[model samples]
Target: MCNHLAFWFGKDPARMDAMFRRSGLMREKWERDDYRAATIGKAIEGTPNVYDPNFGRRVGIRFGTNPGPGPGVTSGFSPPRSWDDPTRLAEDYLSGRCVRVVIDKCYLYRVDSDKPERNDCWEPVSDAWMQSDMWQLCVAAALQEWERKEAKRVADNEKAAQDAEENGEEAKQKKPEVVPPVFPAMVNSALLDTKSQSRLFDDTKLGTWIDGDPNAPHPVRVGNGLLDLKTRELKKHSPAWFSTTKIPAIYDPKEPYPVKVLDLLKYVFDGDDTRISVFQECLGACLSSKLIWKHFTAFEGDGDSGKSTLLNLILLFLGERNCSTISLKKLTTEKFAAFDMYGKAANLSADEAYFESADEGRLRELTGGDWVYWEEKFKSGFKGRNITKIFFSCNRMPKFSDKSNAIWNRLILFPCENVIPADKKDPIYMTPEFWEGSQSGLLNFALDGLDRYLSNRRITFSPKIVLAGERHRSASDSARMYLQDNFVEKDHARVATHLIYADYLDWLAVNGYKGQLESNMFGKEIPQLFKSAKSQTRDGVRCWIGITQTTSKEDLDFRRNIHPTNKERARQRENDSRGHTSYGQAYARLVEGNN
Candidate 1:
């Protein structure tokens, strides 16, 4: 805005445009040179030009004054600059000297000046030296309105004359000739000089870019200057023109930023540096445009252990605008939930209501960078690759039924087992004041973690954290947990097959594990649990080898005389659902018939 204003307030607009354009060319040269700082600091004709000057004087100052340190104060202090300075455009701004003038949008564009299409040109009386031309525009508009009224009046009178002639009566009035409005005459060049600006740009290049191609069918023109993603040194560019979301926080790697915010990671991960290391990598991954690590982090276990704090901190890091809070369950169940994933850097699902969710391949597709369809309400749907990183913070471990590593491998867990006691808990950590000056330091910390992880190109967790992650994953698989609790892998250990089944039923009954009735599920899921375990018949009794159950409970024969065959049980279920005879009575009738 200042640049455009400065160029507009120039005494000779053409000379100012030429000078600024020259400055732009010099800037391009400086960027390509090895010593940009040295070249810019030097002068061109006694003018130090290596600066982004204000009021068309972005160049270095010729004469300046500085007040030396007063007794104890450090130097670098100066009184307010006087208006006599060559660059002082303060008067023009504060006094409203050029408030009524309309500057061309083309002059406002400050990047990639070589492209004529990028310039926003004057078109259809728009960006006219508007204030001065306002009166003439009003007069022309009024004249056009009068012409329209005259045309309508003549048409009505002519119709009446036609009707009278048809009736064989002489017409009372002659046909009135409608005179059309002519274009407004040009003004004198002597009074207002704008001819030079007309020749500054090619007439054919008008409305080629910012205003779009005038001849095309529905030409699209971008309005706001957006952050240029390619070369934004922390996104401080003047005219980006496309991106909507930007990191409001600046990233400076060399600055000394002290942040205690990362202490939340230590507390949540039980102060385990290895798990914290994996966590730091995850933090850094959130900063990227696309999924870098390609995994969702699950921060599980006890409340009041800083998981929420860590979540808020990450939310702060990736601004609330850049991160989406839609749950993973919604991706499969809700209408158009996938659309929320677009344009977001990370998807943070923190609600525990759907924490234990059943993923139906959509979660894998979303985090795996697969191009998926996004449906927007009342708008044409489009396909975009999912770049959003996913994170789930829940008290309960997530439930997934994928038998493969598709879902399990993509989940990394950070255990929040260490609870902050009532007395030791500090409310200050949760307050806004605690987060100040933390973004820069947190960014640096994440960068360090990123560097370490990229060395191997994969996140490495210590054996303990790896075990904890697997344990958390097994929370949904009762069979896996049952195996872990009652059995141990051994070279030659053996147990009667019936005995193992009998013990599984007792364990289920005693533990009161929900949704689990210990009959057919054990037979089906047990065999799939281990690799080498197999069945063998020893002296007429079948036995399972290579595994042993660690229990002292006496095994009751699961296959008793009352026990029905698998086929009979399945038929009984179907019959019950169809309102047939009771299964016990039906079994008795079959036995009596055999007798």
Candidate 2:
């Protein structure tokens, strides 16, 4: 009889099996020794090899000086012919060497002839049989895991900083300089929500809202300021007007004015005319309905020219509660933050007096329809929240040095001449209440018109035009002046400077000039295109022709050197037939006659 022994030897059997019973292989220890190379190929087959532990080759193992067993002959340390017996095969163990095996259901190994030998017919012992390739796999996987975590940490740090900065900015905005610590007498205890104003004030009975009182004060709270709507104020001692001056209300009851005023107020606050006109006149200029219009509309003139009056009139229509007022001195970015926290506003107006203190970029953004950041906590307080409109007034137009032409173009200069003197002294009659009433009705009508018009028509805006030659500039300037004053599409320069060009026309015809006078009209008629041109040279040339505008002194010098010469003179023969005089003398006489 032969003595044969076989037992299961597994990877990290001690470590893995201790953690979980029946886990024959101590995977941690086996994997640490790179035994996967020996296991992967034979793991499913559960076979062991003598010469090649990976199980692809076969060879006999030597135990001390003992040669391995033969298949037919019996040896003392080898299993007997009973190796074919179920009981003997199930109880065998390898002699002195063993490679870790993945036990699926039974233990097996490769024989010299490539036959499978079961556990009962084999001897098992622990010995190192780890493959180098398995260690490489473990190292690569561990490295990848570590790198992923590192990358995530870096990304999180950057995001945290960004969030912190955003939060800080919002904090600054939430507390604007104008937010009051103490309540003023006229201020409403509760601040009005802009969103609700449109709904609550939707009804347009101006008299009902203010009671038609000539001296009544209706104070409404805005974001950071209080708007006072006053009726007529007695400037000095005045007796009750002789009871003889009362007039009957002549308004027709059938045609209520509420719709008109509501509509007009909508336009004063929400009309996208600037955006529309810009899109219409300029190709591809990105216009966002939600953005602030980057231009300014200035009503410049002496005090009484309706500049301030217009501002008041606009507010009357827009609703005193919907507007934000900034003193010219306090209109700073710092001040804007205070306004931002009250949330968003529908209209922002500042007196010309504050233009000097404003941050150019900030004002440009306000005018251009961009939102200001509130900068604290992670919330966006007010953005894309209102139909923002800006109004500015000055005693005179902003000097070129004080603002860019881009800013100037935003303004719709409403030139107010002293209202034909007769109209002024006839008991000038729009009491604040009266004016307010008229505005309420008229503006409502305008808003309805806007609501209807906007649904059907795309709001179009004129594009800034660029011009090319100085000779063509007057025509360009005329067109630009028209566009700047009015948001319409037609070339009004021909209409505005009609008298100036008419004079040119008369001068040309009287001089017996044969050259085309209307040739320069093309550039003059489209001064906005030149003004919109990114290049000054191009815009300057068009302005010069259209509106008496001139090229810059620098540009004039550059163009002067490149001015054309009379090449036509050289083309003609010096001795062409029929003249009774020399060509030079003939030419001189011709020039003198024209002059």
Candidate 3:
């Protein structure tokens, strides 16, 4: 027989109570030391077994190989050294050997006052031990059952809530609200309708070469007008213009994108026509043939100059067919170019507010040349290419070093000085519809004009304008041709230089100059225009005119001359009065002696 007594606690209390009620297990409690015992059986009517009831303790198993008679007594068995040893009483409790004794508290085990049965039944111990153990087991069991049921209920509620959330999301997606496409009056619904046969463009109307090489990765869609993909999902006040006018077609930087510009330049050279007729008005400036300006354009301006507003109008007029807009902050040059330009969506830069001045290095890359390279700067260094067009806005003009070769050469400067303050400008923001309509009106007009001009002419920079006037025709031609051949190459741009000697000569002619131009003649004009223009230069730079002259002022000032008639008149008057020899002979002597 086992020497230990097994005491089980944490029994189901409800079940235990039912058993107690049926079996007459409840009785008056008696105190033994710090604990209380419930009386059980007529044999132990007033014995203490249960402990202080209110202070709860974790119900678990305890094994004593030899139990003492009273509640607090351990039968000489101290706590074991290790909890895992099987032979040890401490080990048995820890190894869960005691925990596995499943107690059915609903059934009471009877212990005879004078007799003992097998291990399954309780032995006749102190009345106190029997009474207290019974009550504790019943209470613990009922609490355990309650906890289990409560956990199940909580888990079920959470699952139901999660399922409802998922269902709600599905319902929303099924009936999503659609956003109507925005368009100008000129881009009628008929153009977009299925049955309308009014063809906006056909193969012939698109010109001979609408799409480029079939094998080319990104092909141009010729017949489609610009397109704006809109949805209610987007936020308001978002910028959305693609190309702007201020940027140039070809930029010059340390590294040139000769390879990249080649393919697009081919299309421009081939005369691929492009036109913009948005909102029933042609852009005053037209863009014809994707070849001339196959690259992207950015527009930068001061705050509230309607940079984003203008771009949005362009998108609206383009009508979700030929154009799309992105704010500048999101633009990644390499990633943007790999996509299609002629698709219904035109790639655009995102909305961006400019700093007071441009970062000189970045401005150089954007406008300087077709490509820019810096060796030690940014390890991989920026190598940008084929930036065909750009529209950007800045609060102030870009700051650049006079010595920086890139930015000074590439940028085309245009100042958008509004006649009215931002607050006084037309209230285009009264309503979305009104704002959209008016902006489309202005943008379409400008784009149309640009398209027409670029399509018809190969714009060559005329240096003749540098020397404007009807009088200096021959001299102007000589100066203009020399500057072109010697300075500006066919591939390079024509810079606005007042340093042209022909311009200086024109200034002299227009101002009414005396003799033919001479080497020292620059000294005369310098005292005038140079004061202002010279201040614009940095220190240590010398200016040269490169002009030839025919005469010298020194030669005219120093040459000896004879005044024969005047001297003779004086001498004749003197002689009439004093009989003096005439001075004509003296004058003749001076001339002859000098010769």
Task: Give all candidates' CA lDDT scores.
Answer: 0.52, 0.32, 0.30
lDDT of 2 by residue, 233-256 (tens): 212111111000101112222335
TM-score of each: 0.53, 0.30, 0.26
lDDT of 1 by residue, 339-384 (tens): 7666565778774554445555777877676666667666566555
Q: Where is model 2 poorest over a 10-residue stretch in terms of lDDT?
A: 237-246
Off by over 4 Å in 3: 1-289, 292-308, 318-388, 402-409, 419-432, 435-447, 455-595
Candidate 2 stretches greater than 4 Å from native:
1-296, 332-351, 354-358, 375-386, 400-409, 418-430, 436-440, 452-595
- List the candidates ranked by TM-score, beginning with the highest: 1, 2, 3
Greater-TM-score candidate between 1 and 2: 1
Can you write out model 3's per-residue Cα lDDT over 337-406, one digit (the tens) per residue? 3222222223444344432233344434433334433222222223324222344444443233222224
Q: Best-fitting candidate, measured by TM-score?
A: 1
Compared to the true structure, candidate 3 yields what TM-score?
0.26
